[model samples]
Target: LPSQVSDAYEKILSRSKDQSWTRIILQIILAATRPLTLDEANVALALAIRKNEPESHSKLKLELWLGKNFKSTVMNLCGLFVSVYDSKLSFIHQTAREFLTDSEPEGTWKGSFNMAQSHHPLLQSCIFYLSFPDIDVFHPPFDLIDDIDGRIKSYGSTEYPFLVYAAKNWPLHFVSQNAADANAFRIQARTLCSATGHQRDVWAPYYFEEYPNSTFDDWKVWPDLTLASYLGLYEAVEDILSKEKPNVNLATEIGRTPLASAITQGHESVVKLLLDNGANMKEQENDGRPPLSLAVWIGQEAVVEVLLKEGANIDAQDRYGWTALSLAARSGQEAAVELLLNNGADIEAKDRFGMTPLSLAACSGQEAVVKLLLKKGADIEAQDFEGQTPLSLAAGYGKWANLWTMLRGFVAIVKLLLEEGAAMETQDHSGQTPLSLATEKGHTAIIELLLNKGKESKLSLSQSISA
Candidate 1:
């Protein structure tokens, strides 16, 4: 029964190619008499017509078959059959018939539009254009018509074909095969426009609508502006800024200024443009850290020099009260630290916790920064709030290399402190003198350096310990 039922339809449709409509009709009757449902017979007949059989009266025959039942199934099949043949009238008629047949009076024929609108706007647009003729399908729904119109108006001129296709056939717009092809076309069109600077009006509209509230200060719009600035289209950015300037002080949602964004992204031209336009160089983000700090933190020496030349505050402190010099020094940025110090940044500036730049450099084992800070008059004996001096910080943290380097470069600092009547045996808040710290951290070289001084003083343990 399954073979007869299945093969019967195939056999009946196969006759259409040979112009065997009469035989097809006879077979349909015989198959129906075999206890198949009327819908089954109609499906068989519809399949026969769908094969593009060379029959002269194929449409007429399909019409006759559909008329027998005229229910939802028949209308559904008719809609599908018409879609395959590009028969718009037949598709609409069947869809309308299904809508009228449903018990719900408010049901309207929305074969593909309904399905397309449920998807992403891009995909929905693709499907609607491919499956339907135009946006006129849902006429009675004035609001839907307006919605579709608004969406269509948003696309570029190059996207007209796709919009047309989407507004028409919801199924075709959503159909993967057709939708991909249409998307390819849209991408190609956009590429051509970008390449040739063509249809600026079309491209400008979408950009303006999307970024109406954007500004030069908004890091979010920085990329777009960077691109435009790279292209030398100062006018484009000017037009946008004329509409509204973003909060000039507003840090990026991710904690960067538009200027920082441009610099970090390597948009030199955009950075120059922004700087010329008065983009703030002293604006701090990521916990109140300035742009110069970020450049130094990321080892961007060139950006640091630029900011410094533009009058960026070299001594600006972050939330931790760490200055640009401290950050650069701790990160082993010798050149950046040198630049900051040359620009009047204090080498001995302490952070919120009272850890000076030299102490931070020594703590991080940045020998070069330690040497530079020492050479620039950093008070080698300066103590933190914890009473830990630079040497004590390096020794306590087990930074032997940094301690050795600091001692070698500033050995006279030790001699000077001793000569100036400094307390070599003074203990920090932790009850550890610089010598004790060096001993605890096992800095043999530093220990030797300190012991030689201790021996030279010849003050016995009682005098040295009491001092």
Candidate 2:
């Protein structure tokens, strides 16, 4: 089936008048996160060429080029191999897409449809479109629809149809491509990072409106290396560090370093690069989380390993005294927990609230983490500052009506703890036993398990008394 589709694709490419342009257009369609509008695709293609041309000159050339080739329309170019429904482009069938994207296509298509190769041009075009001077006009004040003509004049009397797509999707395509060999992408990314005015004032806020921990205001002050690392542009980061030894530990307004940014995004290569180049691993962010804790919390086991090997303090605690192990356990990072345990992390390390790793795991209903902790000799009945045992916390942590599945998980943890010989009648500071807590939360299954265990304990007591 794929062979037949590949044959058709070959014939289509052969019949196309301009094969290289057709290939680039096809790549834009395949690499686009969503179905691109016709105008967006056209702008993307135009930007792919003449990237170094000034916006005004580029606009004139783009219009002339489009006018000359407009009759070669996308539908007519690829014929039956492509489809246009509602003005969005896609392949004729899902199988056609499959044929093109197959890891090991035969004949001429082998290694021709590389993902990095496909995304490189799109990302390049996006950066080119964004670098236009007219981007600043899209910031505010004027309504997008009503002020179209004014903006077009600023864009050399041409509509910048792909501005929004380019602004928002550049990061998506940036990460999709291999950054190791991309000196061009590295330069563009670094240039964007170094932009103090437009990137900060316009595109950063527009692109990262919903991104967590990103303050648009901070973009003005953050070091270029920090921003580049956060964006996960490995080659770009390498470029910045290579030029000279800048202070890698320099914090942004929010007190995050390049290392912290790379760690948060799980960019292993970048993290390692930062570490090898003297990024301080012990420097906590304003939130008080050390690099090791941040890596463990996010379940970046590879990054975690790198940090540990780099001499990151395994038991380093945050401001709240939550050690890396505690964060890993609470977040259900089983592999991280195991790795920390194997690395001699204090399994019984306590947070400021005296909640151990086992306590947090049980309270968070991490069944696998809970089991692993127990096997590693975690105190099953360890009490927190509030005197809540692991069993007590698990039994009543999320007993509310909406968390039915959480209650079930708590029930399982209760049974596991009980089988591991956790005391059934253990009480908290408020004197609530695991059974009483279960009863209060209306956790019927847990209440039953506690009751059965209680009955068995009492029976064993009576038999010993009789003997």
Candidate 3:
């Protein structure tokens, strides 16, 4: 017999011939990279279901379709295998996802669901949905939603669920399309650009909210070549560069060049193209991370190597005085740490907080990195701005949300720290010792390891520190 999960998915897909709402909802959710809120799903379904139909003629039809009972309908149809988590609808199990996406040799019509190319249609929908009336009010630059008269004057329709989703997810869908498809897709995308705010204004609020790291107000000000370069759209990048001269060093609002963006994304071809076209390798964002530092921070080994080969400053520091080596060690990126060390990185380099690379690696439970640092003769008793040693930092980690995962790795980390001659009695600015911090967090494994290491540990009088 087939598994229970497979049976459930088969049953759902089989209902597609019946043209049920369940199939439509599932298609939308499965195609989406991000989870859809219930409100987003309801509004989106209205547009998705009427895709091939003529435009609407009545408010009553629209109202009925976007009814309050949409959630109940989904629950009734697929509650066994689907549920909302954190306000976004998603499949209940990994088996359900695998069954839906992966096809068999003798697949039926329902199993032939085209998931890889799913984003193409969704991209079309987003462009169409944003083209509707009253979307400008949501754009905020127009300030049309500020007053009652402005709302009435500007808005023809104001149900915002579909608008909210379309505004945030258009780029996600576009990026997934192939070069030929993406280039053709830009026809509709560029059509919207002629509208007020150059099309970006409609999506700006949601974009800022979703991508808080984005430093620019509107990427339209930057050439399409710049964005294509950042997204690793190799064909599009070549096409754009062929048409235009090299703007490889062109920057966005916060001084983030195309090279920095590509390095941050680990886009190798794009980085090489920008580099070949004379892009500056040392460009930093407004937040102060140079291209090399960004690569190391995210553990992009190949990109880091390329930057290093291209003569990037191996020891570049951000505004916070954090070096690439320190960032790699603290993030537990072993390959990056090894590469940096092999290239002559400062193993004990301290940041503004006075926390060395070794201390951070041990505190973050990076066993391999800690061993590597110790082998390189990193200071065992180095302290931070708060005078917390590597042992104290490891003990402080008990207060983290991932206590179990950290605790599991940290037991070993603590053993290494002790063996490497880490000072257990070292106190932080709060006057608490490493032993006191571990005891407070109830890390019996680390506590036992500390005691068994044959060191006379002492606790401060108050013992208020924790990981």
Give TM-scores for every candidate, taking all chains together and pairing residue i with residue i: 0.45, 0.88, 0.62
Order of all candidates by TM-score, from best down to worst?
2, 3, 1
Which of 1 and 3 is ahead in TM-score? 3
Q: What is the C-alpha lDDT of each candidate?
A: 0.51, 0.77, 0.68
Alpha carbon deviation, residue 149, candidate 1 (Å): 40
lDDT of 1 at 210: 33
Q: Whole-model lDDT for model 2 versus the true structure?
A: 0.77
Q: Specify the highest-TM-score model's number.
A: 2
Residue 47 of candidate 3: its Cα lDDT? 62
Worst 10 residues of 3 by lDDT: 52-61
CA lDDT for candidate 1: 0.51
lDDT of 3 by residue, 150-171 (tens): 3432332355556656765776
Cα error, residue 404 of model 3, in Å, equals: 15
Roughly what TM-score does model 2 have, to 2 decimal places?
0.88
Q: After superposition, how far is residue 164 of candidate 2 from its true place, in Å?
A: 1.6
Question: Which RMSD values do the candidates have, in order?
Answer: 21.1, 4.0, 9.0
The alpha-carbon deviation from the true structure for residue 147 of candidate 3, after best TM-score superposition, in angstroms, is: 16
